[model samples]
Target: MKYLAAYLLLTAGGKANPTDADIKSLLSSVGVEAEDERVSALVASLKEKNIDEVIAEGKEKLASVPTGGAAAAGGAAAGGAAGAEEAKEEAKEEEKEESDEDMGFGLFD
Candidate 1:
């Protein structure tokens, strides 16, 4: 993930084709030692690919993923007023439990 982030940062900064050494230097500047195998692999894979096109393709693929929430909402809508009331009750119960937990303090507190 760090390698990919560094690559994207370099590309965004006008480095059309960042080399493994460039990635290493960027990582090292922030106290991270770049692994040769990972850097080389990333560079080799992206060397021949257009970064913009690759990102566009990734976005296209991500668009097809199911978010899961929509279907549940659709089903609830189909169930009429009963489902709406149940949903409201569930939400209120959840809020009450959350507020009561740790005397209104979050987990870290």
Candidate 2:
């Protein structure tokens, strides 16, 4: 990820093709150590590609991914049912308590 970020940063800075040495230098400037193998791999992968087009392709691929909203909604529905039961029991307890204290006097009062 760091290697990718460095490559992207150089590309954004008008370096049409950032070399491995450039990536390492940029990382060192920010107190980060760039791994040579990873830097080389990233540079090679992006060497002949347009960064903008690559990013657009990645976005399209990511858009097709499932975000688990359906699973979360189902879990929430199940939890809501259990919560409703607990609320009903609490309501019954409150009703009994209220009946015994109709004069509206509380411990703090």
Candidate 3:
């Protein structure tokens, strides 16, 4: 069931309603087998009119869950900032070493 939901969300791709056959085919391709009755029930429960709606609703629900957009964005920003800071520090160290060498601070000196 969870797999079915994920499949719908994945293939929806910003559409509103995906047909029952489309859902069934996707599930079948992914090795999720079920009787026609069950499949029908599942499709009926989806209540989606098009892929866009499914995607939108799925995104909304996902946003409501933990570790959603804000957390992900914050983590990414923090990671990028940290990486940039490290690179800057390394460059500063390199510049300092170059300056020292230029001033005759080396093994020969």
Top TM-score hit: 2
TM-score of each: 0.65, 0.67, 0.34
- In candidate 3, position 47 carries an lDDT of 64
To one decimal, what is the Cα RMSD in angstroms of model 3 from the true structure?
A: 9.9
Q: Evaluate model 3: give its lDDT.
A: 0.68
Q: Least lDDT summed over 10 consecutive residues: which range in candidate 2?
A: 100-109
For candidate 3, the per-residue lDDT at 8 reads 62
Model 1 C-alpha lDDT per residue in residues 1-109, reported as the tens digit of each score: 9999999999999999999999999999999999999999999999978899999999999999988889988887789899889989999999887784666668776
Q: List lDDT for all candidates, in order.
A: 0.92, 0.89, 0.68
The candidate scoring highest on lDDT is 1
Residue pair clashes in candidate 2: none
lDDT of 2: 0.89
Candidate 3 residue spans exceeding 4 A from truth: 48-109
Model 3: worst 10 consecutive residues (lDDT sum): 10-19
Give me candidate 2's TM-score against the actual structure: 0.67
Query: Against the true structure, what is every candidate's RMSD?
Result: 6.1, 6.2, 9.9
| Deviation (Å) of 25 in candidate 1 | 0.7
* Deviation from truth (RMSD, Å), model 1: 6.1
